[model samples]
Target: MLDTDAWWRDAVIYQVYPRSFADSDGDGMGDLPGITGRLQHLQELGIDAVWLSPFYPSPQHDAGYDVADYRGVDPRFGELGDADKLIAEAHGRGIKVIVDLVPNHTSSEHAWFQAALAAGPGSPERERYIFRSSGEEPPNSWKSVFGGSAWERLPDGDWYLHLFDVSQPDLNWDNPEVRAEFLDVLRFWLDRGVDGFRVDVAHGLVKEANLTDWTTTSTILGGLDPAGPPPPMWDQEGVHEIYRSWRRVLDEYPGGRILVAEAWVAPASRLARYVRPDEMHQAFNFPYLDAPWRPAELRAVIDETLEANDAVGATTTWVLSNHDVVRHASRLGFPVGTPRMPGIGAEDPQPDAALGLRRARAATLLMLGLPGSAYLYQGEELGLPEHTTMPDEFREDPAWERSGHAERGRDGCRVPLPWEADAPSYGFGPTDASWLPQPATWAEYALDRQQGVPGSTWELYRTALSLRREHGLGHGSVVWQEDAFAFRNGDVLVLTNFGSEAVKLPPGARLLVSSEPLDGDGRVPTDVTVWATL
Candidate 1:
């Protein structure tokens, strides 16, 4: 068992995108029961905890990020009883649970949002949301992260802010009601036995007090310059206060419940602020995720992350891929310095699959050998690549329609998991249909095909995780080796070769595992990573 007090500090958390993880009722969508049925898969995979993406009542405008109710389970995902059962089952297997919480905005169908619309211009309900009255133009020049204008106008000559989609409206955090409501919402889940929360848009809750106009015409995804002045809409000073309050609430519970910030703020130093002693326990290390696959770039990010988190008295949290971004498996296939895209299309330049898989495996080994917590995106263990060839007509991500078809959006990476290669729907459910169609090539990556196969990605992950736990590598500090590309965690030395030629190992070092097989000379080949005993 993990140390109960600080399990999150070094825990391996698995992210389950509920809609695409597993389907229980053959409704063509994954649900709570589906996740519960698959807990053993995670247990066998050796993950310390499970962090499920939002499954609350939502319109799914942003794939469940547009929450309609904070305290209830959506009927499509299953009833509240299913959630309770899932939590109980997870805890029974010694696995913790972290649910996603969307506090920055709510679905327009939410009771509060609906009431605000009905209550008109100056009602208390309207005060709960960011409603502004301006002639014809929007309150400001801010653009939605999804696309287009950030404001939606009503017949009453009033407009409301929506940083994402029109179906999701931003809430006025300055309002006391909003604060109190979220506090109660936290208690509701805590009372139901959730171990923690992964806060969505954690840095965006408190925007600039005046709702100031952004002089530049850029979307939230474009991001603020880390070296430049802060943007008015994100990473505001007020956000820290909100998290401080949340930290207190989390402290009130037993078993060390944690709060993870999904803050996309830049420069490692600025990102560290969210994880201060009294604020969030951990924040996603996005700079590391966005780093190029080269050894120097990876080492630089690792050093910055450790240093920054050290200054804040927090353990670093590392993640390679999530629901919002492209899968690293496909991303690493391209050359270094390639810009990140929402999704790849049939017409786009395709990745080198063999090279991508080799690097992705090497990266995962290096990530596991690091001295901090790690988050694994679902299907990554099976070496799943984005369904880059998915037909445009079936695309459903809000970014697709919102961007006027210019951007393909994130649907490619959200394809359903494959369990049994020969079963219907690849054993994702009892039926043969899924919300997003899996590629025909996916059969080769199914769990059944790789479960016990030597050198398979699934087996590689299982072996690495087992070794990581046995060696206490996650709790060890990193000791840099003479080679800038290598570091030692405890007695295990990890080295990655990014050059075109092979690299020789020390004479006395004994090899534990290699992301790829060594050459005839027993040298690490290009794009390969190896872990050995000192």
Candidate 2:
């Protein structure tokens, strides 16, 4: 097994969505220089690394996931030289750099796709992708994650499969050439001194050879369709083989590079396989993120995740929010109105603000104190709440178009960072207009406003991360204190009370961190609390 004590184990990784992180050129979109300028901010937050969302050359159909080139940086983000600078600068600050590697599919405009299309059926290049006979229809009744049929009829009358958007055609992992080409892409970045990669949709690399029809056994999100009936190709058996091959390639690198997979599945037991020593170093655990804010549900998810992953010798990771979903602050019913609740309460509720802050702190402590790596989405440390005001005209997410108005897509959470409140674009850029407007509420939530404020969301994150590093919290065996509803890391114990009442700790326990500080003895009876051995 690869060493579980690598730098990334239990490390806090801050994600940067390039298009909205910072804009250095006043072009209204964030770029590499903007990111380079903010390295100190990350360092101050105690993050060990930064996982930049894809900045590769792409048609932007799916906002850069549909990569057209693996080696080149998108001009909007920066040039190849800028990427090298980012790596060097980040390394100098003791912060590892992990770039997004979208290997599951490539943009239809990718050179390989173009070549395959030009070569016609039966050509060697055609095998690099899933191409079927022109006369036949789609092999199965599978739907894309975005919507509609997963199969698209190409101009040549053949069907090309895409699990996501049509612009992103899934690569045929059955083809050795496809495997070799992607491995080369991995090497290309490693050669450039990248610390590691967050493999996008890593589990979807391989699909079942049979391409059988999905079995509608249960209902999916929105109640529109039933799930459980295996989609034509999700969680295919062949995926493990591909992961093993990728692991071999990663092992060859000298840095002992890390690979974190984005795998979300049920039976919890099956999820652990992605992080087996032979596969990835870590895979995201979405159980807590997806579960309702209830004590029993939360407890069960934690218990099941630990139990399921017991045999895997790799670190576990947790995230509450990312670019693709609604912010946790909103999901937990923190005064944020959804379609279900409109104009539902008093204009200003102190309890709402306090609850939101407490929950945010509790979630951070819970994630950081877990026995694995933790991921922090951009702006999450600042406790930036979601803003879903983007008009249809301004929306760039493909999910927006695909889901009609049923879903807001991810544009709200992906909006520009609020760096400076007074700046025209919240310090994202000096431009009068950004690709997406910064939320007006940024005046209060901007980074500058909360940098050192005690009890502030950002400060809580800084404190939690620093404490984890100082006490070596995530490196030891995790013993869950069932009665206290906490996870113990060595002598340090993280206690969380999802309920509103103050949870009484054992008399001898010392307060290490609390979302709400008690007036005396440095203890607060808040939603969440952490205690360490005195």
Predicted candidate 2 versus true structure: per-residue lDDT over 1-534, tens digit per residue: 457668877788899999989899998888999899989999899999999999999989988999999999999999999999999999999999999999889999999999989998788888998888746678677777776778888777788888888999999999999988988988899899998889887657778787777744311122111245545455677888887887898888887787888765666778788888788787788766776666677779877877777777667677888887767665555533332211111222222444655677677777788777788999988887666455557777776566554445677778888888788887888775588766667778889889878988888888888888888877866787766677678888777775555666767887777666764644446566665664
> What would the TM-scores of all predictions be?
0.98, 0.92
Best by lDDT: 1
lDDT of each: 0.90, 0.77
lDDT of 1 by residue, 260-301 (tens): 999888888888999888888878888888888877788889
Top TM-score model: 1
Q: How far in Å is the alpha carbon of 424 misplaced in model 1?
A: 0.7
Residue 313, candidate 2: Cα error in Å is 1.2
Could you tell me which 10 consecutive residues in candidate 1 have the lowest summed lDDT?
Answer: 215-224
